[model samples]
Target chain A: MNELVGLSIGSIRQRLVDCQLSTVELVDAYLSHISSQDRALGSFLHVDADGARAAARALDQRIQSGDDLPRLAGTVVAVKDNITVKGLPATAGSRILAGYDPPYDATVVARLRAAGVIIIGKTNLDEFAMGASTEQSAWHPTKNPRDPERVPGGSSGGSAAAVAAGMCTVALGSDTGGSIRQPAAFCGLVGVRPTYGSVSRYGLIAMASSMDVIGPLARSVADARQVLAAIAGYDPDDATTLPHVNLSARAGQTSLTGRRVGVPKEYVAGITDQEVRDSLSATVDRLGAAGAEVIEVSLPTTALAVPTYYVITPAEASSNLARYDGLRFGQPSDRTHGHGAASARLRGQLFGREPKRRITIGTFTLSAGYADRYYHAAQRVRTLIRQDFARVFDQVDLLLTPVAPTPAFPLGSVADPLAMYQQDIFLAAVSLAGLPAAAIPVPTSGQLPVGAQLIGRSGDDNLLLDVAEGLEQALPVSP
Target chain B: MSDTTPTVEHLTKLANLELPTDEQAALAAEFRRIIDFVDALRSAEVGEAQPTSQVTELENVYRADTVEPSVHARTLVETAPHQQGTYFRAPAVFGGQP
Candidate 1:
């Protein structure tokens, strides 16, 4: 509905460069949109309009004075609250951290700011980026812009909501399981969950340390591409970051000719959701029309994805979230009886119902008696999932699958926890494999924004984005 | 996977929450349903697979443990709901009065 909101980030950058749109003006426009519509949409938990305007004005001055401007000068971005932004609240959507402030910027935030992007404020999320829907947020749930009553799938729902509602041109969100891609699919945006090692994890409030990856969710694939290009690359602060790779935007030379896309039989079989299956099938056809080849391939271990992901993520999350014992950072008094009593109190009060449940399950699974039965078994299954992807990559440039079992379910609709876990079936495999996955919406199907997932080879992050961008253009966004 | 004796104290300790007796039956049923769902991995054959703690190959990258200049301690502590001097304050765990 918003023409400017739908503009690709690269094009917007060019418009600003050509003086057609000033940094300050664009920031103000976005601020006006947020003020007008964000309440209903629940897009942002914190909106720093004045701060972003000040930064945007400074960038405008630099450009006006003919200074060498940063790559994303004055482009406004909405940040997930899990990420630290100096002087802004980094709540992670938990009551324990409702007002917790970080003294410094997250490594990614620092990089985005260095690129001259104006960070408007923090978006809502699942408490500590834990749940699939923003419904888990302590603040408010972000509704899907396409259908306001349905959830904008999360834990990055607010990020997707903000982008879809034209509150921010691009936003950052972390994906552990389907956090980024699910929300992106639900909201009809380009959600990129990059190769695990591609982006740094420094200063992101840890959920599952191994599985968490921060990526861009935006209105268009190109906008997602631009945002990824800016904050991706390596950070010395994060041990897991892969060395930087050079990405060239050979504009208009986008040709998918000879790019082989594999349709994994295991991914498609047994899917009962007609709308989701049809959307993926249609997307495959669209990819072919966009000059790509498609073939049916098998990833037999696909069934193990959710099991492996739940095991490994909970195990890792138990370790990652162990830091929030109400002592050093959060509600400090809860754990302050001294030593062991302190840890007990801190752990109980600071961590909410969901976090405690997960940590409990994880610790039990990893306990000495059960490690062989659960934790080690899950690890072995993870290798099988990766091997399945590896074998498929040998046959095709990309592997296509339905991003989830269904389109966005209604907020609070899932009553069973297992059903909630079932939603991550398509997502968990790529995460376990440590490969790249891009979620591009299928235009037909009334634009429920069902994502047709593409899995790229281990380090080929750019190729997936290119394929997504190409498919996006071939099939215009619907609904 | 075996239900022998209910290690009520031990399991409660692992669960971290102080649960009252009335809620235990409900929580147990819920946990059993979850475990049964995840047990689907048993049928998945992963004989030759490697144990993947992390997906990619990354060794620890460490920098010197020098204390770099950080934001003001007072300002960082200021956001906590309850603060005394430099520390955060929260409710007592269980029934232990402090």
Candidate 2:
């Protein structure tokens, strides 16, 4: 492994500040590492090697001029392709938008650039951020760096794999129904899904608008926290961004004494994998040993989360993706036919199997005569799901659950879409309620890493990070 | 709730997607399974609970009405697959020779 690639963001910053390592050298190291390692991993769809080198050179000159460095200076970050980076082909892992390159940067990308972070490349994802595995990606699937046969989880699989394999310091991934956290768990990295409205959604190709949030995947809780802080805050471009949001984690707080952690019984009830069950038990024991009170809590509507999420996400996705007609900035179809026919042909030919399935499902649910039963009912149940979290949060400061039922499953193992949807059973409910959740790797004797999810109340993102940091410190590193 | 499974033809027409004839049957089966799975939402008793379309409670967020400089029309139009001047070029909507 490259020495610079193994260094964390903090150590890299220290090295840069000490004049021991130049930003160009760091970027070159990562670029070379990516070029050599990424062919088999398939983590990146578009690597901006020139762009990254240019940015690093500019930063190195600034350092020589004695300018105050930005908070995340000298860090190389991989963005999931769905989030537009100015002049990069933001494919969203779909053929529909294959050659489309946005002329402007996403709010998060702009912020990361302003923070002196190098835009390394655009990582792959499931088509329109839909599937649990990168197998659904229009491009080749991203393999888990840990065990190449298994998936890295998705739709942020590429981002997770990039960070896991040390291709980048940290990467940004959008989470709607565990896209970020599941991949983090699979890759043995820390992934955060910040509370909805906490981070601006501008420039993100919308999948499920209401539940969509762009967060960070890093090897440490602290790195995730720093990246989240840089990208988070109000943006006029995105009306959903909350004003007066506080993202500061408690300073130097690592002890979990007197903290209240709840284990939702429903989240763990269906775990058939003995390894996952043992991992959860070990996580609970670690939390207890850290002086936190662990109590069993119930979220009865938990089972309804996947159904609700599937309905609502597809419904929103259908509407959001309606903008992808060939007339716009995507693949164009032969225009000998009428406009309507052209649109049908373009979408049919361009969209992958999962996006089409979702669009059809969304149209079905929201169609006349069916909206009352499926779409509206799911919305009402969404309220109940949120209430379940609201009720449980009143008793506990945070909740702990398994990030996924098992460790990363082998690539191509889950074929059925419904079976794949079941993978989010422990994750979708948090998304439905628009809560903040983090997936941290827990020690497991097995070859693959198991992740424990720490779900916090809405806007308590900092608390989640603080506790995760503490637990991360307490737990023995997985060998 | 009606027990009738949605036909793929109806859904494809509604969604404006042209599924290949060979793939429709497989997609139809997948759609049926998904619809059946999501039907579980109907079992939850959501008595008197209002729908939550957006999580953020902020409503009627309005910005100043004053116009701001926007992306250049040419810059925006350049991204389109086909463009005429500053406008996107598309197949005739009225189904006539263009």
Top candidate on DockQ is: 2
What's the CA error at residue A51 for candidate 2, in Å?
0.6
Calculate DockQ per candidate and list them.
0.39, 0.82
lDDT of 1 by residue, B1-98 (tens): 46852343465576455554555555566566666666878887776767888876767767788987666887767666567887765556455564
Specify the poorest-scoring 10-residue window by lDDT in model 1 chain B: B4-13
Q: Best TM-score goes to which candidate?
A: 2
Clashing pairs in 2: none
Q: Estimate each model's TM-score.
A: 0.92, 0.98
TM-score, structure 2 vs. true: 0.98
* Candidate with the greatest lDDT versus the true structure: 2
Q: Candidate 2, which CAPRI tier? A: high
Can you write out model 2's per-residue Cα lDDT over A30-97, one digit (the tens) per residue?
99999899999999999999999999999999999999888899999999999999899999999999
Which residue ranges in model 1 land beyond 4 Å of their true spot? Answer: A1-6, A247-253, A335-350, B5-9, B20-25, B60-98
